[model samples]
Target: MTQLITERSTDVIAAEINAIKFQTQSMMLQASSEIGKRLIEAKEQLQHGEWGKWLKDNVEYSQSTANNLMQIHTEYNSNPQAFGNLSYSKAIALLGIDAEERENFVQENNVEEMSTRELQKVIKEKQKLEKEIAKKEADALKEKKLLQQDIQDLKQQLEDAHQQSTDHEDSEKEINRLTQELAVAESKAKKLEESLKAKPIEAATVEVIPESVQKELDQLRSKKNESTDPAEIKFKMRFESLVNEFDLTLHALDGIGNSETKAKYTNAVHKLMDKMRATLEGGMS
Candidate 1:
């Protein structure tokens, strides 16, 4: 029974110690919030240089320690509803987060129940995850922009290709039209050539006598018709036939190849015709 009582007492002592530790932690957090509030009030009332000197002289706390305590309280004191269960150290660890984040962080990680070191570790992991997510989002946005640019480039290329195709089609049509026009022109030229080939060549024909030569022939015919003597009539008829033969021979001279030969032949024929004309005139007289 004595042993049982000793065990029971030991259990009660442990519970009391735990309770005291809890109360102490709570008091420390409250003190931290109160200290932050007092510091703010003191700074408002005091000058900067005077406050620094007074803090160093009157308070045993160093500037840095005071600032840390003040920050911890500033972050959690006003919003004690969320951090009421956190110890001063644990609340200090959560000061890295904003007021809005603090409530969520406490709920998410059960920060009130966590040790200060544990809370810090969890925050570190959370920051790393957020950083990775931000990097992925930035990379995705960059890729999306690049994809849009590529699509625009492809669309421009397609437009250029389409324009080129249209231009080529127009060129082909022009070429075809020109080819058809050329064919038509060639056909017309060929038909003209064929028509020229089918027709007979114009023969070398007799040229018309000069007007002066025609008047002389008319006078000669009138004189012949007035002649009554048989010999005169015979001479006149022979003279007229000779003149017609001379004209026919002159027209035939057009076929001569050598100009010198043609001139010599023409001169000889003129001399012979002159003698015959003189003989006919002597007979008529």
Candidate 2:
């Protein structure tokens, strides 16, 4: 019999709970008459923003408390074309028993407060933030353009400098090449002159150097013996020696006497000496 008593008690509690829920739902539906006009007036007063969506979600969650709000949320969400379907009487029917219940619902579910000025101020702040973002974007674009131009100018300057450096190097190399060529030409000219001096090549002329003429040449060869007893003879002898030495040293390479013809140098010297002797004898007399 103890098991039977426990089952009966459980049944009684369950019935009481069901009855309480029904009464609660009935009372909430009755208050909608007062709240219906107020809710519409609030929605119309403020331009809808995030708060509109918040209100809609809250109304959907209100299903556990009452049925009217849940139906409204479902209808609004499903059929966007079915607007303004709320009867003030129907919304008033959905209002709960007292202000305490409404305040608790608002607090727990984040019901938004309705103020046009506050909503408008928030919108203005958002717009200001958007404008600041646009300005920052424009400034960054301008800075990027300036940086790109600087990079371009640096590239041009680098190219010009490189060209100048290449030109300078080419010029220096050319100058060095020309200098080397000139030195080579000068060296060739000097080598030719020295070869000419080293050569003991024969001239075309054949001058006979007889013993008597050679001995006579030796006597009058020195510059001191050039002045003899007679001033005229001394002058003539000096002139002859001067002519011969000048021919041998200065004009030896010029074609004068050739191999085919010969001068009897001894006979000429004897003749000159005899003339000198005559002139001296005449002077002494």
lDDT of 2 by residue, 1-285 (tens): 455543568789999996775465445533442243345555566575744554567554232333444434433333322222223233233232233343343345332342334434544564566566566445435534543553454355445545555556654443443333333333333433442354332322222233565465445433221232345444544544444443344223333365333245535546776998899899999
Candidate 2 overall lDDT versus native: 0.42
Please list the C-alpha lDDT of all candidates, in the order they appear. Answer: 0.61, 0.42
Worst 10 residues of 1 by lDDT: 199-208
For candidate 1, lDDT tens digit of each residue in 176-203?
Answer: 4333333333333343334234432112
- Location of the lowest summed lDDT over 10 successive residues in candidate 2: 200-209
True lDDT of residue 55, candidate 1: 80
